[model samples]
Target: MTKRIRRLTAALLAAALLAGCGGSDSGSNTASYDAVAEESLALASGGTESALLPDTATGESAQKIIYRADLYMESTDFDAAQDTLLDAVDAAGAWLEYSYQSGSAKEQDRRVEYTVRVPVENYSAFLEQAGQAGSVLNLSENAEDVTSEYIDVDARITSLEAQRDRLNELAAQAETTADLLEIENQLSNVQYQLESYTQQMRALEGKITYSTVDISLEEVAVLTPTGVTFGARLADAFGGGWRMFVDFVQGLVLTLVYLWPLLVIAAVVVGVVLVQRRKHPRPPKPPKPGKKAPAPPAQYGLPDAPAANAPPQSGKPDAPKNPDAPQDAPAAPAETPEPPKPKY
Candidate 1:
């Protein structure tokens, strides 16, 4: 009886070992537990097991999703087109984190730059609607594949998990605390490595799930009054110059008009002052009678009066020696007297 009980115990131990071997070898202990639970549930439900089963995955994977696009559209009114494009993005439940626009009416062109994010499932549908925002001029898109990297991370995670599990089993069979501590330390390192792999896989999956798109718009040139001909522009410039000249002439004339009255008043005052000065002319004093003028000297060409000191001329009876001259001849008187005496 003792030999039979020992045989039963050995056989049960072998069966448990085989079941654990069939579980996943992935670095994730959670995956291993899930497989074991699934098989146990299947057996309890009386489901027949298959002879051959596919090999289970025992690792994490990595992936990256990246792409770019270029789009073009046209519209008569720039503002309207811009509004419609914005509306489309909102309706698609997407967000544009960056955008820019610049252009001129002459060129009939406007450009926009956008960095956007949309739901992974809605990327294709949103792009189709965006195409109708205006006239489509050009379109191109591309995506990069990273399936190989995903499988690589999965394989690494599997190896780390198996190492960690083996260390746990060793620590359970340890004879002392020191031996158990050593095994635990190695297990910690393996678990940390496994966790690192998991984080990397999640990141890759996120990138592959999202897509990016870029778009541009072109404006149509239209006729407007602001776009005048060369001749019309020249005429406008000349008109401005003429207006300035006319204003300057009018200012000069106004100044002269204001000064005319002042000039007339000054002239009248000057004339009145000159007339008053002339009317009060000074009178001349009469000449006084001075000493009579001396008579003119005798003429040089005529005879002049004789001097007082001059002798008497011989033409007159000579007042001869006597002051008083006898009346007859004295000699004749003496001879007549002698003759009368003789006759008596």
Candidate 2:
């Protein structure tokens, strides 16, 4: 009986060892299968399987992508600066959407909007390049990883595609046109869902791949003024004002000076006219040649005075004047007396 008990104990030990070996083999096989599956799922080149399709996937996980950047630059040459900015964009493989100038001569501003395709690995490098375009005044950068949302959207797309394929197969099996129409309507609905998901995916992809860059450019002004200063400027302003005032006064004086000749001519003409008016304006007629002027009559029956320059006319004319009978003059004198005597 002791021998029998020992045999049974040995048999039990062997069975237990066999069971343990089987358990070990089963666990090893399961581990190997999981590893193979993980490797296969991680199909992307040079990437881990988990990176492509994460352990946890959902519809809302991979739908959001966030990226933004803003920078400022200064350059002396606007065109060259703009060219440099364009080159930077090209280097970054960005889309130039908008650019423009702002402000006046002294203060000018230039701004450019570029939608840059920032490779997930090269976002930092892209920003560095953009900053090298000019002197950076202000810079801002932001990023958000949407690995969860992306996984979610991908899973939803897979499910939707499977549903659509199934609907297509149902349409193909339809025996009647009405059945086909119903299947088609269901297919259409699936397709619409697929389209909506596709659009959302594309938008999410755009947000992930392309980061927005808002760049502002300012022209560097060399503070070198052409020797203009406070005192000099003030002097210039005062001098300018004084010159203007002088010019105005000179113009007035010149205007008055212009009338000087006219005033002089008028005064001369008036003086000459007045003098002529006061003098014999019309000349007197000349007297007749050799004609004597009438003499004044003797006053109160007095004998006429002798002319001062006359010759001594002789006594003869006075005696003939009436030494004879008529006292009035020699009258008919003697002849009259003789006639009277004859009558007696």
Candidate 3:
């Protein structure tokens, strides 16, 4: 009985080994077949093996370029130019991402700016059409190539997706709770990385597909010349000076208009002052110093009056003293004159 059990055990072990070998071989064959199918699909789509592989020197793809432009222009008629710009944008099937306007019509300094997004196919045509909106003062264009970056991001995304799929498969096949949890954690990390790279790829594609244009539009009475000749420069200088002067005058007028209330108040104050002055006129000024007044005119024919107590004139003969005049010689002693009293 012991010998029979030993033989049976050996047979069971050999069967188990054969089954394991067969399963491994089948899995490898399936993997090889999938790889071949993928390669065939890539070839059918005009892609090479190198293109399917990352970090290979033989693969080449279309260039991914981001285009940007800046345009500064001036228009004689702001309304017309704005219409033209809108029409151009509509014709090009472009949209305005941003728009802003500054200054006012009264100042003749109205300005409008636009940020536009246009398809790559319509970039040149849109630029040409936009130039007609006004006389271009400045134009600049730039292009950035993102082919390498695009390829790198795409490859990384593909790698992360593959890693996530492998981790999911491992999680499903995991026998222990600990192994399953670890695989799930790894899968989550791979998923997060995939999402981030996918977003970057989409952003790159958007920039590559659409071109950006920054347009500045200014309202002006006259178009600036593009010439660099001495005469043109001189004319531009004079024109600029004239425009400045006109702007200053306009600003001054606007300032006055804004302060009309204050001006009215000042006028009312002045009127009140004048009315008060008229009601109470100032007194006349005093005579100036160092000027003497004229004396009163002399009488025409007035006789001279004799002085009181005057003696006989020296030139004329005197009358003899009479006896009555001798009575005054013995006049009593003259009394002292009394002091004058103070007057109220």
Question: Which prediction has the highest TM-score against the true structure?
Answer: 3
What residue pairs are clashing in model 3?
none
Q: Model 3 — which ten-residue stretch has the worst lDDT?
A: 15-24
Candidate with the greatest lDDT versus the true structure: 3
Instruction: For candidate 3, write residues 119-228 as lDDT tens digits.
Output: 99999999999999889989999999877667656655554554455455555666677666655655566566677778888999989998999999999877777766
The Cα local distance difference test for each model comes to: 0.59, 0.57, 0.70
| lDDT for predicted candidate 1 compared with the true structure | 0.59
Instruction: Go through the candidates in order and give the clash count of each.
Output: 4, 9, 0
Judging by TM-score, tell me the better candidate of 1 and 2.
2
Best first by lDDT, ranked? 3, 1, 2
Candidate 1 to truth, TM: 0.38
Clashes, model 2: 9
Rank order (by TM-score, best first): 3, 2, 1
